[model samples]
Target: MTISATIDGQLVQWRDSKRYLWLMGAIIPLIPMAMWGLYALTGSTLSWYFGPFFVYVLIPTFDLLAGLDPNNPPEELIEAIEEDRYYRWVTYAFLPLQLVGLIWGAYLLGGGTLPGIEDPLTVVQKIGLATGLGMVAGIGINTAHELGHKKEHMERWFARVALAQTFYGHFYIEHNRGHHVRVATPEDPASSRLGETLWEFLPRTVSGSFKSAWGLEKKRLNRLGKGPVTLKNDLFNAWSFSVVLWGGLMIAFGWEILPYLVIQAVLGIFLLESVNYLEHYGMKRQRLESGRYERVSPAHSWNSNNIGTNVLLYHLQRHSDHHANPTRRYQALRDFKEAPVLPTGYAGMMVLTWIPQVWRKVMDKKVLDHYDGDVSLANVHPRTAHKYGASLEGAAA
Candidate 1:
């Protein structure tokens, strides 16, 4: 049976392994909401705490708190890129939750309907909420990362909306065509240099991706002979959309409430950028004779396969295979023997990235191994000889 078939438990006339992954990836957003829903339904303070703590503390800790070790037992599933149906599905399921969260957040900001808790979860509840928002921030971008790569207009549009919610929409463009292509080299601003710290990477990634989105879109627009993407383009629209959307919320609620939104979005983007800082930390693409970077190989990006996070996150942590084959679904993306493996999952790696020196100290050796120092324009976008092209027959190019 095909990988996606195993996940969806059904066949497809024109499907690969992505059905389950896409289906699952869309579900991550609903988790916190489900928790919130239970709290709402139960009308209990403890219930409120349950949702946040699990999302914030428990789920994120699978990799970080555990120190990212997954004891080997079952290699029962090794998903690949094309089977991202699960990944995409989770994302789809999660979106309505985002809207609900936004509405709830707006309500809280507006002082409309935030029910008073009975004090059972006063402290833990707060921590859970914070962590929940943090996860929202983190997962928001990760979703954008996945959606941004799709060729569908709806996918790209949803990705933009998600990014805008987090105030990091530029990632949609810069990541898909820019960073993933030029990563590990000086050309890509998102990828941290060998000696760079995570702190230094933050502003650069934030600003660079934003501006590069314009450039990337411009390339596409120019290719199609379109006008400037100032207002009509989704990239720029994210900025305007958020301004009005949040502004309306502030007017409805209070300006003070805006801080929560900003903080959460900032934290979320940081969560993602920190991960970007980790992936390809010391790796660079090889130059080929045609003046392009070599094929998207396992060596180009880092990989991690903590079972819990891998399954929960829709295998995003196994990035090497995803980058190696951009169109591959997340479910089918797997750990390749040749690719480098991180010691922990994304959450753990993210925590590790906070301490720049410590992160460098830990990952220094791994980075050095894949450093391709002598790259030039003579070697960019290297020809990929692998058979990834055959998989693009159905959904998109």
Candidate 2:
């Protein structure tokens, strides 16, 4: 669809080339069903692990093959594209499918058999299926992210529903009110530091974000003369959704599925944290005269334009625009030329994060270059400050 707007007495027309491709994100939740179908056909355990293979392998390969998509809608047409209800509907569709997938996965994990299989799955296969479900749970968090940023009440609630699968409901509170406010600063737990491996970042972000979310909610509720434990506390309320969902699933599927549930939830949390680790790795906003960090800008975030990951992740690879305009719909996000570009899409970069040496080799120079070789300007991890000729005081400053 071509959208036109008049700017300075000139007609400007823009068409979103990836309009339909956005549907790929909604299709992610159906991977478990695909897993079942593949298993039914092939009877191979490999089919059960397809979700991880698809996300970690096929998506990265696709990113390399698909290359970049530098298209940006005309400034005049951003609102037009944002208001197009079709885009939001696509995101809404993901929630139902995600719920269905989780329920179906639970049934399978509980030894329930479907039409295609006369025999129950093996323990190894169940573990593979759990990992696959973890992929959906993690990606569902991304879907929740897009919804959580919206102003609509329903969308915010939908965000909580999506998060229930991963037991990460508190992210809705922390990401919007906590991380966004302090991003690229030492205080922002979600922002990764230079020389911090993914192994090191995982526990920090997970635990820190939970604490930060609770604190934010407690402060908010205190103003209303309410305790943090109340349902009115956003953190408490959000977490309740996870408790209720998981509890209900356990009741329905029996207690034996508990271990698999934990496995998927933990893996999902790891996946989300891995993305957080990469988003602002080694980037820091400077302090102002008043001892406050400078406002976040395009420079504070790493960005990618790889079409495959962009489509799969709902343009989340355009992190610069997302931080700059938090409420902007995914379809309307614009790429900034000034933003630091990653070597490839997020999927490929996530793979690099597993090998800290390889990650540092690939990204440390990029950080240095982004700061014009000023080591002190980067968010250098205090322990590795000497490696970069930066004092611990300067790195922590």
Candidate 3:
């Protein structure tokens, strides 16, 4: 059932499910809320694990059931979809749920009342509870990523607030200024190199990103004649918000609550990083004779059009369009035929990336295929290029 109309003088079409898209947004909050409710009613420690379970377990199963959606909206409607306030408001309305979920989960674990939860929960129980809350915090990063890219003033600030829930506020400065500029090149810390395992990439990215963010911020402040000591420094201000958040949790809950908050926030941060690793795993920009890399294009980042996960992620899997045009709102981002693609959505891929052998087995062939078997066209990490053996000569270049 498709219908067509004119909006602001542009043709618009409503597809089978697009008209009811707002309802899909509830999946973000409802799944975790339901899991928490189950834990409260039954007092089963195992119930606390359901949040991550639902994501890593159930979502991937559903992905198999729902299959891919290759139908992109008509090009003419891109502008109309962007102009529609419905999509923007859906992203905005999600902000409160993130804040409430964070606070509510903290209360559940911090000896606050619930039917079956005991005062002073076991350390094991606390960890389980934190794991669930961490999934919510990870989704907060997704929320921040969607909003932070917008040019609007208030939406940008709200992006920072959403990121602060996971103590990842610096993502605003680094992702926009640093990663976007250096992505797919050897210089970008966020992009995983050939043969690098998630374990190896994690520490490097986690530490390097902070360093990159600070350096980027410092340069900006320097241009304005400000220093780290000044409140005008954006990095300092963003991190200050995170510090205040951590301190607030300790005050509102207890000193004991601090550890759970820290663990949960780290889990959220790791989840975002894991996604980064897969997005550009073995790809790189070609360096030109003039000593500059070729301009970023759709080929640089991996794309996934898995319908169910794309909806859940607000179409973040459309990475090719995003890197090529950072300002394009998520709804307007399109999948390109030339873009490299993942075998599955992010949830399933996240699990695969943890096992280095399986990840390489699945993705290495795709990397070679994307560049027509020429390792020179790919970003082969110097240490592992020899294994691809035939292309080693050119790959070293």
Residues 135-253, candidate 2: write the lDDT tens digits.
99999999999999999999999999999998899999999999999999989899999998999888888899999999998898899998887878877688788999889888999
Per-candidate TM-score against the hidden true structure: 0.72, 0.98, 0.93
Per-residue error (Å), model 2, residue 219: 0.9
What's the distance in Å from true for residue 230, model 3?
1.7
Best by TM-score: 2
Better of 1 and 3 by lDDT: 3
CA deviation > 4 Å runs, candidate 1: 1-57, 64-88, 113-115, 118-131, 222-229, 369-397
Instruction: Give the root-mean-square deviation of each candidate in angstroms.
Output: 9.6, 1.1, 2.5
Error of 1 at 30 (Å): 5.8
Which lDDT tens digits does candidate 3 get at residues 260-360?
88888888988899999999988889889999989999999988888767777788899988898787777777889989889889889999987999999
lDDT of 1 by residue, 1-397 (tens): 3432243564423233334433544455555465567777886646544533554456567555434422221123433333435446666666667666765655544445444433333444434454556567577777677777777788877777676667776676678778777776657877765556788778877888877888888877777778755566757776765777677777776775666677667767777887788777645565579988666677767778665566556668778767776765555565677787887776667667778778867776565444433222111222211112212221011
**Candidate 1: residue 1 lDDT (0-100):** 33
Badly placed stretches (over 4 Å) of model 3 are 1-16, 19-22, 30-32, 118-120, 390-397
Model 3, residue 308: distance off in Å is 1.7
- Residue pairs clashing in model 2 are none
